[model samples]
Target: MTPVFQPGQTVVRREIMRGEPWIAMPQVCVQDDGDLLVTYTPGGTPMVYPETGAFPVGEHPWKLAGSTSWRGHGRLELHWTGVEHSIFLFWDGPQRAFQGWYFNLEDAPRRTPIGFDTLDHELDVWWAADAETYEFKDVVEFEETGPARYPGRMEQIRAEGDRIARLLDAGELWWDKAWADWAPDPSWQARTMPDGWATVPFEAR
Candidate 1:
């Protein structure tokens, strides 16, 4: 009961099979309500909680408010703190597409200092199961870093995404046109990770 966004809003994230839309800006603590206590449950020490590589994994895992669900399927882990991430998904019994994994935090050739390796970082994932979107941006031109943790320097995130895509191609505002429309489509093919994760159980959907 604590999820609300404002600052330039438009977070229509509908993920089902391949329709990943964007536009969610307003930086600096972006309207923090403690971001729902750091994305749920005792999770309130932020630093982007590994930059949004969310995880918990089964039988009520952490229920990011997706309600309650499970039939048979589990796997969750996304780590982004300077960039380097991974995603795994499953749930198909009540019709939630299925199968997912998209990571390319800069040529993920299994780079690990702790956990995460299987770098097929070519960056390609986009799922839009009717309207339940999923998006992971970064076209290509590898060499990434600068969420700032260590090996940070993808040419300084391409000179700060080319100075925010030249101020949204000169419109010069609106949060740099929401970071140049944050073109994300990476690719995933499954559905329903939201309806409160359907009771979260069957191995943590």
Candidate 2:
């Protein structure tokens, strides 16, 4: 598989929460085997906090929370194997180091002119750093929200989760230990989201 992005390429990754954009720069890496990897440090920017309620309202949409400046929280790494399946590794803030892999069962990312986009399936698997244990991370949450959100795809999504779970349990998964030791190049300047990034709506899987 040809890689879609070159290593060290800068790209904007935005997460839309309650119609607001939370953007970050994810550095790209192309593995020897042709899989693509992207990593970024999250929580550096001031995030939007809903003013009135947990859900968004027309009157008071959001307010900026955190420092006015960017602050680094933890590193987030994503390995995309054609988008049908992607593995995410997060920095466990409490543990103060790399946590473990999160298996996101979703549709393959569609390449856009600006960047890639994909909607996440509700189901996910969390593999502990020890690699000896794992658990279903969002089962109840998915059950509650998935039917309303995904409609007919819940069964397929759960099947994908089951397939990944089996692979993980059989020790057939891969984890890049080198990433734990990896850090971004100090020479790279801070990134901001380009204009019109939020205009494109990411389709649900």
Collision count for each candidate, in order: 38, 1
- Which residue ranges in model 1 land beyond 4 Å of their true spot? 1-72, 76-89, 92-96, 99-107, 111-125, 129-134, 137-147, 155-205
* Best candidate, lDDT: 2
Across residues 1-205, which tens digit of lDDT does each residue of candidate 2 receive? Answer: 2336554555544433333433323433333233565645444433322233333322221233233333454445565656465776666455457677778765665454455555456588887677777888878978987775567878888888888878777878466657665555655544445556656555423
Per-residue accuracy of model 1 over 169-198 as CA lDDT, tens digit each: 565432111321221122311222223221
Candidate 2 to native Cα RMSD, angstroms: 5.5
User: Which number leads on TM-score?
Assistant: 2
- Estimate the TM-score for candidate 1: 0.22
Estimate the TM-score of every prediction.
0.22, 0.68
lDDT of 1: 0.27
Q: RMSDs, each prediction?
A: 19.3, 5.5
Clashing pairs in 2: 44-71
